[model samples]
Target: MILSTLDLNPVIDLTDEQFYQLCQANPEVKFERNANGTLVIMSPTGGETGNRNFEIGADFAIWNRQTQLGICFDSSTGFRLPNGAQRSPDIAWIKQSRWQALTPAQRERFPPIAPDFVLELLSPSDTLPASQTKMQEYINNGVQLGWLIERKTRTVQIYRPGKPVETLNNPSQLSGEAILPGFTLDMSLVW
Candidate 1:
């Protein structure tokens, strides 16, 4: 199923702590907060999408283990962006230095920083426009590199700071570039 968003305008606004509690209470549900405070409730992905997400996360994890240059996170980790949005990318990475800057307490909660690199894998239920908008948000909030992979079309949208969005069609692999030197994602498993 597609994701659903709720705008709780008439109701009292939920404080960050309250949101955290709510999330903790509902462990089975996936939630996100937009910069404007809209609550997004996303359903669990289908089996195929879940498997793809696992494969993508595993690839990043292996690369991270080899390089030790950064920490990789799976979809379940939430990050509080500078713009006040709480986002959980399908796959995310933060530089070791940036991660080390956070205190132990901060690391235990949703990190209040943008990820250096993010990857969003599009499931069949996801809309292209919505995914593109999310990528733009990530870029605007200081994400240096972002990838929106659309399995349906075999297309990848690459987002880089201060650069126009680049589109690749059916690419066999994606380079991590300077941001993640010596890292490459094999598209065979993802596609």
Candidate 2:
């Protein structure tokens, strides 16, 4: 890490509220780290990272078939963890009901709870142990399911409560089973 003193102007510390306004002024800037010490998300753009496996994520949401519900490809939306960590998922399933439960005022604020489901696409530079712990974090915070997609192997690591670890490799099809009934993702699209 490079640390250097600025010679242009005196170093100024901005509060969280002030930093937000600065981001507003400079639309091109993306300030992931904040003064409050939030853990900026470490994930990739689903559109670019896994254009090959998109159908899988799409098929899962399509199986759900609820218009008020949908999947998020970019890790833009974030929810604060109980531990104050703010890790975003590459993809998330936001059910209408759970979301509607929030009042308009509350919706404007960071959600107190995590999404119903999360999917993490593994990049070549990503570490398995870190993603595994993130998967567990979802379950610990009441997430129903978490999918860790391995791009190279074209496999998925499924995480569910009270279930054994499952690694499906080039399966004919992938199903959300009961969690997302009738949702079948044709693996052929991914390969």
Candidate 3:
């Protein structure tokens, strides 16, 4: 969905604690913060986007459950990236070792670590440029792999560290590669 940015610069810049508290106070809303502390309020997705997201998330959840090699997180999970931006991808996965390294408190809150893999599914109100920018931000913050899926265009933009993005058109499936071995996403469910 299209995001609305709230600039709380001179008025009152929200500190990390304040942002966390704001999120806590409004449990029904989804929020994200950029490196510059600009608050991004995300709109709720339509039914089609929600269904596709759930299907994709379920695929990742099942893979992670079987592999037990990492932790899978849904859209509700927020992460504090190295760049100091708090983001919540449509789906996220972090290596088991990395997740275990965090303390209980860290795990309980928005974990201060980037996910190894992230996926963003474009909704009707979502813009391709915005999604691409978000994916690049993920890579800059040490995300190993990211996928920006635009269902309307039947395209996938793959992001990786130090590598140019690879676009796939109407692929039958997507492989997890080295990041998520033995995992494959069924495009049928996404379509």
How many clashes (backbone atoms < 3 Å, residues ≥3 apart in a chain or on different chains) does model 1 have? 0
Among these predictions, the greatest TM-score belongs to 3
Clashing pairs in 3: none
Model 2 reaches what TM-score against the true structure? 0.69
Select the stronger candidate by lDDT from 2 and 3.
Answer: 3
TM-score of each: 0.97, 0.69, 0.98
Query: What is the C-alpha lDDT profile of model 3 across 1-191, one tens digit per residue?
Result: 65699889779988778989999999998999999899989999999999999999898998889999999999899999999899999999999999999999999989999999999999998888888999999999999989899999899999999999999999999999999999999999988
Candidate 2 whole-model C-alpha lDDT, 0 to 1:
0.60
Where does model 3 exceed 4 Å of error?
none
Cα misplacement distance, residue 10 of candidate 2 (Å):
21
- Candidate 1, residues 1-191, lDDT tens digits: the string is 24789888469688778888889999999999999889999778889999999988888899899989999998889999999889999999999999999999888989988999999998878888888989999999999999999998899999999999999999999999999899899999988
The digit string of per-residue lDDT tens for model 2 on 163-189 reads 766888767766665655556667667
Superposed by TM-score, candidate 1 places the C-alpha of residue 57 at a distance from the truth, in angstroms, of 1.1
The backbone clash count of each candidate, in order, is 0, 0, 0
Worst 10 residues of 1 by lDDT: 1-10
